[model samples]
Target: MSRQKMLARALIVFALLGACGTGARLAAAGEFVAEARTIAELKAVFGQVESRTVVPARARIGGTIREIGISEGREVKEGEVIARVVDDKLTFELNAADAKIAALQSQLDNARTEFDRAQQLLARGIASQSRLDQAKTQFDVIVSQVAAAQADKAVIEQRTREGAILAPATGRVLTVPVTLGSVVLAGEEIARIASGQYYLRLSLPERHATEIKEGGTVLIGQRGLSPVASGGSAAARQARIAKVYPEIADGRVIADVEVADIGDYFVNERTLVWIPVGERKVIAIPPAAVTTRHGVDYVRVATPDGPLDVAVVLGETFQDGGGPRLEILTGLRPGDRIVMPDVAP
Candidate 1:
């Protein structure tokens, strides 16, 4: 054959291969059928981190605070001494009790000597029996007086020991209201502590009160002024609704959520939380299959005629075991096939 004829035959073969490639690419495109999928409808609301129990360490004795050992943000153990209070009057009373006891002891010794002399004198027939009896009574009276004084001193000592204020619970100290040298009365709070496990407190509208139930799950958003889920791991954002209060207040219903490792969170710190209020059937698909053009979203649908681009109203993004999914609010019907963009060659 001539060289020109051979080149023409090669060009024809290349055209035939290109046509076959086009058909193969079209056949390889993936398709997804739209269906009604039941999803939990989540309502986003602010949740405030709070401690389960707030306990106050109070002064047991009225006095001036002599020393303070704790401040705000400090962790404390139960029965730990946090402050010390000392009353000067108590010390003086203790001293007075000791003096009274010493005086009675002296008197008791003198009475014993007198009683011994009286008994000896009576045995010798020099002292009367009535006199000996009177001396013995005086010795017994002095002994009772000494015992009473000693007991009074013991009570004063106990009061002095009570001047030390101890923490009522094991937790972090939230506030220290009293300072060293500050005068405080008995039972006055020296410090306020946040105790027990920390949780999120949510207040929702009364209209959704019936939907909120114990043991339900909620999604935690990133910590910030506006709490929006930021594609975080499922384990980090998952939490359980631990409690729901029966009483509604101020047109709102209250609930508690428990999360693992919220111990470091500040009390009363607000964060975004998504609660499942109800379930509804909706069309959802992966975001990769949808394309955005000029502020509108579009998805390709495989029709009997050919592939067609259909307009879709997009809802919120949610997570499932497969990955992040975009909600289709409109323009998609059940049994309609969707063309996957990534699967195309």
Candidate 2:
């Protein structure tokens, strides 16, 4: 098929997704359930998923990238060699340094012999003391030169050994900025990696700067562990605001929200976050009263006349003396008793 036909078919397929009627069901009498309580109002906002620890792999010296052993999105171990830097020039310099040391050592040996001979002659009164002093100074200078040459060679060898870039921490590679034969400067970043743990990065409007505080509650809709629900991991978990930035940027205040099951999310994934800036009254019911069918949530209300089966939009689940309860977003009202699904009319 032609490209245009394929594109048109794809659009049509997408347009046909989730084709269903959204209507509530009616049921008879059931067990009595609790009511929703008005709690802190959560303000929904957009946020990004990011790793808590970002590790950057850098080059120790200015050289061309000889080889890259890892690719983007690959997991790496701590201290594992991921890339090599070409340092042929340093290798040649190191060889020269060794040769210089060898030459200096030979010169020092000859100087020592001459100094011994001058000392013997001066002791036998056949040579002046000044001659012995000159020979001693010459021997000492040659020794110092050999020591300096050896020290320089050691430095070169150390740098040459450091040509291999190792991962500082175990993590999934985010990006390999440099490829084979890419010339990178000393201390330049060659790769970026994420160190496992992830969090929600929220950018709240600066108007709520004062309202945003550490330890405040947030509702996160994403993969992994839920911050609020106990035990089972829910897509929408209650999380707490881990940090609130002191400074505002571009009319926004940024904050970090810590959540569990960070391993389930990839870095930089976009998600919706809801933060409770203040509290209000809300209707809630016990979790037992809510039922799911075909992925839609519903609840039953108990009226004095009979058990009214009302379709309810489920909200945040909270706990009081009555244990875990679900927030009724719609289709219910205050003072309406709810019935558990297992209860009979």
Candidate 3:
């Protein structure tokens, strides 16, 4: 064939391919739509799920640890004994005090007897007044010594019982820092526990500091969770912003979201948290019609020429009765018709 003829054939093939490409886009017109809706306002953020209350079990009296009653990850009830400290030293102190009291008691008895004798003799005009006064004074001094020894014994006895560290609250023991035979000081931490309830802690940009307040709703969920089959499980996921920290650190505002069934989550586990910041009109599109490719989100929009793949910036993905929906922050407008492509968006 002549060179001109060959060029003509190549042009015809190029035109055919363009025509077919247009046909595919035109066929997508039935699958998508652009509509103005009050999509639930939300901001998706990554956060750590942690126990809202963590209590430390500490040794109240200095002693060597004698027994550890619970292991890590063990559930303990409030007031349950977590460990025992050897009370041998405390026992020795109490015994010494008791011995001192016994020895002093004998002296006190002798003094009291002499005071009685002096009193009897004085009444009969046989004892000097100085002798009676000295006897009475000696008796009183001995009595005070005995009382002081008894008080010392009482404190040692109380400390002996307190050697057994008890759980501060119902919780799962997270760690046991002291082992059996380890000597510990008074007020030293022995174990750390996660108090039963938990919350999700997250940081938002400091710019949102003024907007976060207590009682604000936050949706919390882990990755790979499908829509729950039961309505009860769905309701359990609702979280509220229980506390908004007053101070900003590193350009972020801290907030705590309280949830009821957070015990299943491990401490510091990362999960998604969606806070409802504010609401406004948005072009909401169903997730089924949206396509993601190479880190970009796209949806097929039916243009005047034909269906076109338009890149969209999705704000926050929200769920409702229908299913997951995307909040289109850019690239679409109200009254624009769209469709799901036969292959993909």
> Cα RMSDs of all predictions?
6.4, 11.9, 7.1
Measured by TM-score, the strongest candidate is 1
User: Runs in model 3 with CA error above 4 Å?
Assistant: 1-34, 38-43, 210-213, 223-237, 276-345
Residue 290 CA displacement from its true place in model 3, Å: 8.9
lDDT of 1 at 280: 93
Q: Against the true structure, whose lDDT is highest? A: 1
Q: Judged by TM-score relative to the true structure, which candidate is superior, 1 or 3?
A: 1
Better of 2 and 3 by lDDT: 3
Q: What would the TM-scores of all predictions be?
A: 0.86, 0.72, 0.69
Comparing 1 with 2 on lDDT, the higher-scoring candidate is: 1
Q: List the residue pairs that clash in candidate 3.
A: 32-338, 32-339
Location of the lowest summed lDDT over 10 successive residues in candidate 3: 227-236
Error of 2 at 183 (Å): 1.7
lDDT agreement of model 1 with the native: 0.86
User: How does residue 150 of candidate 3 score in lDDT?
Assistant: 91
Backbone Cα, N, C clashes tallied per candidate: 0, 9, 2
All models: lDDT? Answer: 0.86, 0.78, 0.80
Per-residue lDDT tens digits of candidate 3, residues 189-294? 9999898577788899987787779998777765423323222123326778899999899999999888776664377776667676677788777776777879
Worst 10 residues of 1 by lDDT: 227-236
Better model by TM-score: candidate 2 vs candidate 3: 2
Ranking by lDDT: 1, 3, 2
